[model samples]
Target chain A: MQTVQTIITDLKDKPGALLPILHAVQNSLGYVPPEIVPTIAKALNLSRAEVHGVISFYHYFRDHAPGKKTVRICRAESCLAMGGKALESQIKTKLGIDYHETTEDGNYSLEAVYCLGNCACSPAIQIDNDVYGRVTAESFNEILTEQSA
Target chain B: MSITVYVPCDSSAVSLGANRVANAITQEAEKRGVEINVVRNGSRGMYWLEPMVEVATDNGRIAYGAVKTGDVASLFDANFLNGGTHALNLGLTEEIPYLKKQQRLTFARVGITDPVSVEDYVAHDGYRGLKNALSYSQAEIVKHVSDSGLRGRGGAAFPTGIKWNTVLNTPSEQKYIICNADEGDSGTFSDRMIMEGDPLVLIEGMTIAGLAVGATQGYIYLRIEYPHALEILNAAIANATAANYLGENIQGSGKTFHLEVRQGAGAYVCGEETALMESLEGKRGLVRFKPPLPAISGLFGKPTVVNNVISLASVPVILDKGGEFYRDFGMGRSRGTLPLQLAGNLKHAGLVELAFGATLREVLYDFGGGSATGKPIRAVQVGGPLGSYLPESQFDTPLDYEAFAAIWAVLGHGGIVAFDETVDMAQMAKYSMEFCVEESCGKCTPCRIGSTRGYEVMDEIVNKRDLDKNIPLLRSLCDTMLNGSLCAMGGMTPYPVLSALNHFPEDFGIKAA
Candidate 1:
């Protein structure tokens, strides 16, 4: 029930307020609602195209609703060296989804990230807020089970 | 007095199950009715033995690492509270060769102090640089950094002091200081470590930059990938502000500086300064042409100073110890310590903060201890995805900036990702192009088009569709991307592709041309 007005009211005065406002909207609503774009543009005095342009540019902001949990798998060099490629393939198979796609049950969404800044522990994956490292196929399932339980 | 047990709260360590181990230790302590004070510290950078639990005994902090949740009860059973013998005991934390040999100048407070505690930070000589800066003139502060020979640790290797000097001399009613914490590089994590471990140091450094350049407002443009770093940095900023070390009239110096953390929507190109500013302006993360550098016409079109986390973090130490003290550590123009992050198929993949003169062989064998898979290390990629893939023959090259440049490689961000013999260099080269295609801001056509073309050519080469024609075509495409591109995204993509071809052409189903 978080409205665009609530997100923009506090942020409109700050310099470069669009990003923070967009982040706030996405954070609360789980996605940047397309209908709210006109409202955001009006509040920030930006054109609808300008607001739409920004939302589409960055990969983090999603226009549509997301699955309950976003699964980001590391696709960077360090992780790739430590079996990240395999892990990526395994996770894709397990979840039955590719990058940017949500599961049919709306329980999971897969993403391909370059690096998680956890290079020391390669083959890292972030399930929502928690990042798991040295993640084998088995450990990945264990994590899901532990979380859902 | 309760016995103190230190557990890492570092994101990397947490990713490796440190949180579980911490919870287990707390529950085990409660079960045993042991009066223990568990302090969550940052990682010591020895990641292979992460979840490195430390106990403060009369001797010193003894280390036990790679600890699991199941190992907690046994640790208590063995009375590890007194630093007793345990199978996982790593003796004194300082005595470990991997950590002991590291001249941890910037990382001195990391893993040792409570991250969010300002008191702990001050006790570990954290704000000494800012305290020292308050006593000197702005010119003196800039001079200290210049004399230290500190370059942009975010891979550009641009002189930090020169950037500050430009901003300092620029006359502007409202100047800004932006810390580029958008660490998008594949094999690097030192910036993340600093932000997560000793965030105050970066805050102190940014404050010093603000003081040096007469900027009243500062913003850390951190990437969205690091949620833990975001939390830690926010907490540290709040804590620092509370201590009067960050806000108006900092430390009663009557000088005002306000700091804020701005999250970047996941765009790799935003790591570029101009794109970063563009992103900061709530626009697309597109690269802008130079001549009016960030110091000249930066964020909000005002005189601004943009610095990397490591370069900014290094400032506090440079100010604390005179420039000469830091300058004397490393060789040539690359003075002071470089916290080299060794990763990917390395047995001891961690942070090794050594001086400039160390060779790649020393880092790979002496520090890294060879491949994690027990295979001979074949190709090592330094810098990030843009860095060249060096062969074993070039391993003897010293880690100095000039030396790396002489070998057609870069010491970019001091991130070394090693690949074993089983790695297909052709695939890696292809991935580099793909990464460029994915990350390109699309401001320039060369990077955008050339990357896709590069991927197509590599696919042809990989599949042996037309090795002879496609190989030369790949070189031509690389040449176009190298010169035609607007920024490093296109310009440096050739490094990995060409280097992979030059060094491991056999993998591409062809001999070196």
Candidate 2:
């Protein structure tokens, strides 16, 4: 596994290197550690404040570690036009966690995304990189069970 | 006998279980001891029949659609490998009514070929435009586009030639061509389709822009939501580079252009050209005030040519078929076709690339097949999140940019999200403001603070608390955001809110104004 220093060292020279660096760190480690902020800032000749600001401003980045699986439900208008809200409530109840909350067992972390570009088949949700469509509450439970099994 | 089969790998098709269908077909073929070849192609945009399987036959590619894993065995038993009778069969892929009825200049090769195959792309007339562009001088190239009357399809509808012309005139040692692939609009997926389905076209388009404007480097700032598109684009880039369609000295022409894909961390505001540049620079996604437009001082303070995915993608066709030939398709100042995405509550939802001037009513009933619930489609939100919501009364309006503007509506990005009669306009209005608040980059006071206040006032309006006061207050706040916000993020947020409040006041507990 490439360490945080190596990721920063590799990407620091690219123009507008901050977002790409943060994405690389997050993608590999699942979260950007606050401790590495100073190191990243030093490599990029940016202040720790500037680096921290960039990390916090974008919704996709996170400073803390997430659960084993992160579930992002689309809450945009297209999803809402379908039964997304109802499905959202069912998932929250099933996992015992609301949006942005992690389950006690760290099995799941819930988040809301605006759109997954599956508008034609609305009420979409993405787990990691895989997006599912026309998902009802019942199907979601089945999908979750299948993935875990 | 070795038979060819196409299973869509387009992300939307995958979302609808295309992958499972693909796996089933392969496994079934092996089980039957039959020689078969499987091609993971892009979508046909007929999503209602997704998991749609096509077989290469004497009558062209026959389509079997909305196929499930359970149905795969039956299909093989029915001799579907030879395009035999099947309950799910939808006839020749090109003959589908929904697909054949409209123009498809920009999306010509999208669902028709292997997304990353350079040879397939060349066979389908992919690089003809770039090759034609290579022969012309930079000014002549710009004039061809200018004469084609291609406007930005990324919602702003700015003339593409004007933006390119400005960048061409500005002398700079370093110039950048940025393709805004950060398509964060809730109801739009045309950009995603082009990237995942025919990425080589975009590569060709960007390469042409680089050659025309004297820029050597180009970047596609794609949103992270499109992980599938990212994968396809990178693969296509590599394939194009290896084929000399991209990278330095293309086909030994001596002109060099390098392309890279930059992933955005999900900021809606970054769709704005200036904010996109700011985010690209590894800073907070904030809007920059423009006196020196992006064409003059952009991307590291050098001349930049920033265009939407559709605008750049359309360039190849304009060049391939002369500008006048391209200009002959649409109405008014809006030239060429727009890849209209029918989403939300619509039945048979998918992408329809049509010439401008089609009435919204014709689209709703003719292409859309009305609402999915079989009820009346009460509202249609054209464009993306910030676009205005038009009631059924306004359905007769043509889709021209100027025509839509006559009613204060915009054909923004050509994404039409329908809502059935059961939808509550008040709730939709509230979500619009809420979306603004969630995605605002907080660069200026009007957008950052105004959106927050707009959301609150909407909450008050929805709750019927101080209705008279709240309604007036919401409008005032919208005024502030419209005039004061630095970019469209803040400026356009009111389009939905006000359009909702004005068009469907009954839902807001008031009579229509």
lDDT of 1 at B448: 92
Give me candidate 2's interface root-mean-square deviation.
Answer: 0.6
Candidate 1 regions with alpha-carbon error over 4 angstroms: none
Candidate that would win on DockQ: 2
RMSD of each: 0.9, 1.0
The parts of candidate 2 lying over 4 Å away from their true place are none
lDDT of 1 by residue, B1-513 (tens): 899999999999998889989999999999989899999898899999998999999999999988999999999999999998999999999999998888989898899999999999999888999999999999999999999998888888899889999999999999999999999988999999888889999999999999999999999999999999999999999999999999999999999999999999999999999999999988889899897888888999999998899999999999999888889998988899999999998999999999889999999998899999999999999999899999999999999999999988999988999999989999999999999989999989999999999988888888988887999999999999999999999999999999999999899898666
lDDT of 1 at B61: 97
lDDT digits (tens) for residues B204-289 of candidate 2: 99999998899999999999999999999999999999998888899999999999999999899999999999988788888888
Clashing pairs in 2: A16-B281, B49-B66
